[model samples]
Target: MHILKKGLVILFGSILLSIGINFFLVPFELLDGGIIGVGLIIKYLTGMKPGLAIIFLSIPIFALAWFYNKSYFYNSLFGMLFSSFVIDLLSFSRGYIQLQIPPVVSSVFGGIFVGLGIGIMLRYETSTGGTDLLAQFLSKIFKINVGIMIFIIDALVICLGGLLISKESFFLSSLTITVVALFTSLCTWNDERTKLKTS
Candidate 1:
C-alpha cells in the first residue's frame, strides 16, 4: 500500500509537470529551471524531442546518484523515467492547443503546475532527479543552501536559453523560473514547519 501510494504520487506529479511543459511553457518558448529547462532548450535548438533530451541528459546525474545516494537513486529513478516518457507521449499538444495569451500569464500558470508537481513529489520523499539531486550532493560538500545552488543552476540554463533563443524568451523564462521557485517553496513550507516542530 505504501509503495502503491508513492507510485501514484509520482505518476500524478509527472503528468502535471508534463502538462505544464507541453501545454504552457513549450508553446510560448518559456522555461522552467534546472535540467528540465535544459532539455527544453535542447529541443528548441536541435528539433529533438524534449523527453528524449531529458532522459539522455539525466544519465550522468542518475549515475552519480547510484553511487552516492542509493535512497535518492531509488526514489527518483521511476519518477524520472515516467516523467520523461509522458513528456514525449504528450507531444501532440504542440499542435493541439496554442493560446495567444500574454507570455507572463503563461509563465505564471506554467510555474504553478510545474512547481506543484515537483513539490508534491518532494513532499512525498521522492523527486525527478536531475539538478535537484546534484544540488543535494553539492550542498553536502559545500555547506551551501541547496535552494541557492538550484537557483543558480536554473539561472544559468535560462540565461543560456535566452542567449541561444531570444531576449524575450530569456526574460519570460526568468519569470517562469521565479514563479516556479515561489510556488515550489510554498508547497514545501508546510513540510519545513512540520519538520521543525518534530525536531
Candidate 2:
C-alpha cells in the first residue's frame, strides 16, 4: 500500500511538472533550476528534447547516488524516468495550448506548478533525482542545510541559463525560481512542524 501510494504521488507530480514545463515554461523559453534548467538550455540551443537531455545529464548524479546512497538511488530512479517520459509525451501540448497570459504571470504559475510537483514528491520521500539528489548528497557531507545547497545550485544553473539564453531569461528565471522556492517551502513546511511536535 505504501509503495502504491508513493507511485501515485510520483505520477501526479510528474503530470504537474509536465504541464509547467510544456505548457508554461517552454512556451516563453523560461527556465527552472537544476537539471531541468540545463535540459532547457540544451533544448533551446540544439533543438534536443529536454527530457532526453535531462536523462543524459543525470547520469553522473545517479552514478554517485548508486555508490553512496543506494536508498536514494532506488527512491529517485523511477521518479526521474517517469517524469522524463511524461515531459516528453507532453511536449506536443506546447503547440496546442495557448495560455494568452503575460510572461510574468506564466512564469509565476510555472513556478507554482513545478514547485508543487517537486515538493509533493519530496514530501513522499521521492524525487526526480538530478541536482536534487546531488544537493542531498553534498548537504550530508558538508553539514549544510539541504535547502541552502539547493538554492546555491539553482542560482548557478539560472545564471548559466541566462548567460546562454538571454538577460531577460536571466531576470525572469530568477523570478520563477524564487517563486518555486516559496511554494516548495510552503509544501514541505510540515516537516519542521512534525519534527517540532515530536521533539
Candidate 3:
C-alpha cells in the first residue's frame, strides 16, 4: 500500500515536472539543472528528443551504480523512467499546452512546479536520478540540506548551459535555479518536520 502510494506520488510529480519543462521552460529555451538540463542542451543543439537524451545520459551513471550498490539504482530507475517518458510524451504532444507568460515569470513558476515535483519524489525515497541522486549522497555526507546541494550542482550545469545558450539564459536560469532551490528546501523542511513528528 505504501509502495503504491509512493509510486502514485512520483507519477503525479513527474507530470508536473514535465509540464514545467515543456509548457513553461522549453518555449523560452530556459534550462533546469541536472540530467534535464543536459537533455535540453542536447535538444537545442541537435534537435533530438530530450527524453531520449536524458535516458542516454543517465545510462553511464546507472550502469556504474550496479558495480557499487544496486539499491540506489533500483530506487531511482522507476522515477527516472516514468519522468523521462512523461517529459517526452508531453513534449511531443505539447500542442495542447500553451502559456504565453514572460520568461522570468515562466522561470519562477516553472521552478516552483519542478522543485515541488522533485521534492515530493525525494521525500518518498525515489528520484529522477543523476544529479538528484548525487545531491542526496552529498547531503548525507556533508550534512547540508539536500536542496542546497542540488542548487550548487544545478548552478554548475546552468553556467555550462549559459555558455552554450546565451547571456539571457545565464541570468534568468540562475533565478530559476534559485527559486527551485528555495522551494525544494521548503518542501524538504516540511517533509522532514512531518516525519519527525510522526516518528
Top of the candidates by lDDT? 3
Ranking, lDDT, top scorer first = 3, 2, 1
The candidate, 1 or 3, that scores higher on lDDT is 3
Q: Residue by residue across 19-99, what tens digits does model 3's lDDT show?
A: 889988888889999888889989988999898899989998788766756887888889999999999999976787688
TM-score of each: 0.91, 0.93, 0.93
CA displacement after TM-score superposition, residue 29 of candidate 2 (Å) = 0.8
lDDT of 1 by residue, 46-108 (tens): 879988888889999999999988998999989988888988888886686777778789888
lDDT of 3: 0.87
- Higher-scoring candidate on TM-score, 1 or 3: 3
Quality of model 2 by C-alpha lDDT: 0.86
lDDT of 1 at 120: 80
Q: Residues 1-199, candidate 2, lDDT per residue (tens digit)?
A: 9999999999999999888888888888999999998999999999999999999999999999999889999999999999999999999866777889988888999988998888888778788999978876786678554555666788999999988999988888888888777776676677745755786
TM-score (C-alpha) between model 2 and the true structure? 0.93
